[model samples]
Target: MSFYLSLDDVPDLARGAAILGTGGGGDPLIGRLLVEECLKNGKKIEILDPTEIDDDDFVIATAMMGAPTVVVEKVPAGSEAVRSLRALEKHLGKTADATIPMECGGLNSMIPLVVAAEAGIPVVDGDGMGRAFPELQMETFGVYGVSGSPLAVSDENGHTCIVDTGQDNQRMETFARAVTIKMGGAAYIAEYPMSGADVKRTAIRNTVTLALNIGRTLRKAKDKHLDPLAELSAFLKDTIYGHGTVLMRGKIVDVERFVRDGFTQGFATVESFDGGHEMRIQFRNENVIAHKNGAVVAIVPDLITIVDVDLGTPITSEALRFGQRVAVYGISTPAIMRTPEALQVFGPQAFGLHEPWVALEELSAAR
Candidate 1:
C-alpha cells in the first residue's frame, strides 16, 4: 500500500535508516532535519511500493556522496537533490517517472524523500542496498549489472556535473569522488537510472518499510521499558536479515580517525566494562571489521552495528566516542549479497582483509 510520509514518520525512518547504515552512510541527523524542514515548508512526499510502479517507468536512484562531517558543515541548498535528478533526466532525454534511494542508510535514505518532494515524484519503497555501504558501486543494482554511468552530481553552490563513464562502475565512483572532493567535500548525485522492471528485480525489496518498522519497534520497546536489543533481534530474525547477534557490550576505549580520498577512515576499540575482553573495529565510513578478544568475529558484507545500551540509538562511525557504553550487533547480509559476484565486490577481500569471508550465522555459531 502507498502512503504519504508525514513529519511524524521522519524520526522513526531516520533512526531505522541509521541502524541499517551499519555505522556508515553518514549521520542521519542532517538528512532527517532536511526532510523535516521540507515537511515544515509544506512539501508532500509519497512512497509507493515497487509493485505499483509500471515496468517501463523510469526510476532514478539518488544520494549524497562524500564525508558525512563535510555535509554537516556545508548544508545543502535544498535544491541539490532535484537539481541532480533534472540534470540526469536531461542527459537521459526522459524525465524520471519516479525515484528510489540508492541505499537505505543514514543520509541517502532520507535524501531521496527530499528529491521526491521537490521533484513531485513518488519514491519507490525499495532501495538498492537493504542497508548502507560506503561506496557507490556496492549496491545490489550495480551487482545485478546496472550501469552507473551518465550520473549527475550537484553541490550546494549550484555547480553541477553530468558524467558518462560508460560501463565501468568503479570508474564512475572514482570520477564522482573526485567531483565531490572538488565540490567542497559533498555533493548530491542522481545515477543508476533503471526501468521499474529492473528496479523490481535488482533492488532490495521493501527496505523503506523495513527501516520504518525497525525504527518503530525500537521506539516502542523504549516506551514499554523492554529490552531494545532483544526487540531488535526478534525483528531482524523475522526479516531478510535473519538472526541478529550481540557481539559484545563494552565501552569505547580508543579511536583513530582521519579522512583520506574524500572518505572517513578510522578504527575504534571497545573494552568490556569488566575489562575481561576487548573489541576492535575498523571502518571506512562503515564498520568493515570487528575483532573480539583478538579474534576476527565479523567482517564486511555482514552488517555490523553499534547501539547505545541505554537509549538504543545507533552510533555512527563518525560518532563513536571514547568511554561511551555500546552493544555491537551483527546481522546477516541479504542472500543477493552472498552470491559469488556480490562477494567479490563487498567481501573481506574487497576491503583489503586477507581473511576469508565468514557468514554472520557461522560467526554466531562459533560464538
Candidate 2:
C-alpha cells in the first residue's frame, strides 16, 4: 500500500522519530519546519512499503551527516538532499527509483521525505536502522553486507563530493565526517544504493508506520489524560522494538560534554526528585550506557531515550540540560541488532565500554 505524507503528519512523525532517535539524530524541529514549508509550497511526498517495491528498483538512502548542534546552526539549502541524490545518480549512471532514509531518527527521517517530495520519488516505508546510531557504518544495511559507497555529500553552497570508499564503510564514514566538518559541520548525503530485494531482506520493515503509530499513541494519550509513558510502553510490546522500561525519572543534576573528532561526547547525571538515587547516562551522539548507583542498568545496542515526563516528547543528547526533569526509557532494539555479528559493530565494546552485551529484558528483570 502507498500513502502520502502531508503537513498534518509532520508533528506526529517528528515526535515518533525523536523517540526512536535514542538521544541522537539531531533535533527534529528544523527538519519539521523545512518539511512543512515544502508541503505548504504544494509539494507532495508518498511513502511506499518495502514489499511493494519491485526486486530490481534502484533505491538510495539519504541523510545529513554532522553534529546535531551544527545542523541547527547550518541549515540545509532546502535542495541539498535532492542534490546529493542526483549527484550520486549521475555518478552511478542511473537515476534512483526511490529514496529511503538511512536511519529513522530525528532529522534524518524528515530529510528523505523532503527529498522525495522535491525529486518526485516515493520514500520507502522502512529504514536501515529501526532506531538511530551515531556512525554511518552502524546501519542494518551495512551489517547485512551492503556497501556504503558511491556516496555524494552536498553542502548548502552547492559544493559536493562524490565518494567511492570501496569496501570500507568505516573509511567512508570517516571521510564523510571530515568533509562534513569542513563544509561547516553538516552536509546532506546520499549513498548505499541497493536493489529493492536487498532492502526487503536487510531493512527494518514498517518502521515508518511504527514511528507514526508511536506518535499517534503519544498524542492520543495526552488528549485523553492518560499516561503517555504507559501507552508508549504498551505499543512497544507489540512491535519489533519489544518492551520499553522506565530506567529512571529525575532532575538532571550534572552534564559533562565536549566536542572531539567532530562528534559530541558526554555523560549526564539525573538525580531523583527527592535527591535519593541518581542515574548516569553516557553518550556519543546517542546514549551508550546507563548506570544507576554504580551498577550498569542499560547498555548500547538497546535503545536509551530521554523524554519530557509531562508531554512525552523525546530530548536529544545535544538538548539535554541541567535542572530539567525527565524520564529515561530503555526499549529493546530490533532482533537483527541482537545477533553476535551485529553486536560486534554496535555493542558496548564498540563504544569503548568493557562490558558484555545484555538484553534490555534481562536488565529490566534484574532491576
- Per-model clash counts, in order, read 0, 0
lDDT of 2 by residue, 1-367 (tens): 7899878899999999999988888788888988899899998988899989999999999998888877767777679989999999999999999999888989988999989889999999999878888888888888899999989999999999998898799899999889988888778999899999989988988888788888999999999999899999998888988889899999999999876776778999999887889999998888889999988888888888999978888999889999988999888888988888788877888788998888989989998
Instruction: Give candidate 2 regions above 4 Å deviation.
Output: none
Worst 10 residues of 1 by lDDT: 69-78
In candidate 1, what are the lDDT values of residues 55-141, reduced to their tens digit? 999999999999877776787766897899999998889999999999998988999999998889999998887787777888889
Q: Which pairs clash (backbone N, Cα, C closer than 3 Å) in model 1? A: none
What's the lDDT of the predicted structure labeled candidate 2? 0.89
TM-score of each predicted structure versus truth: 0.98, 0.98
Displacement of residue 251 (Cα, Å) in model 2 is 0.2
**How many clashes in candidate 2?**
0
**Residue pair clashes in candidate 2:** none
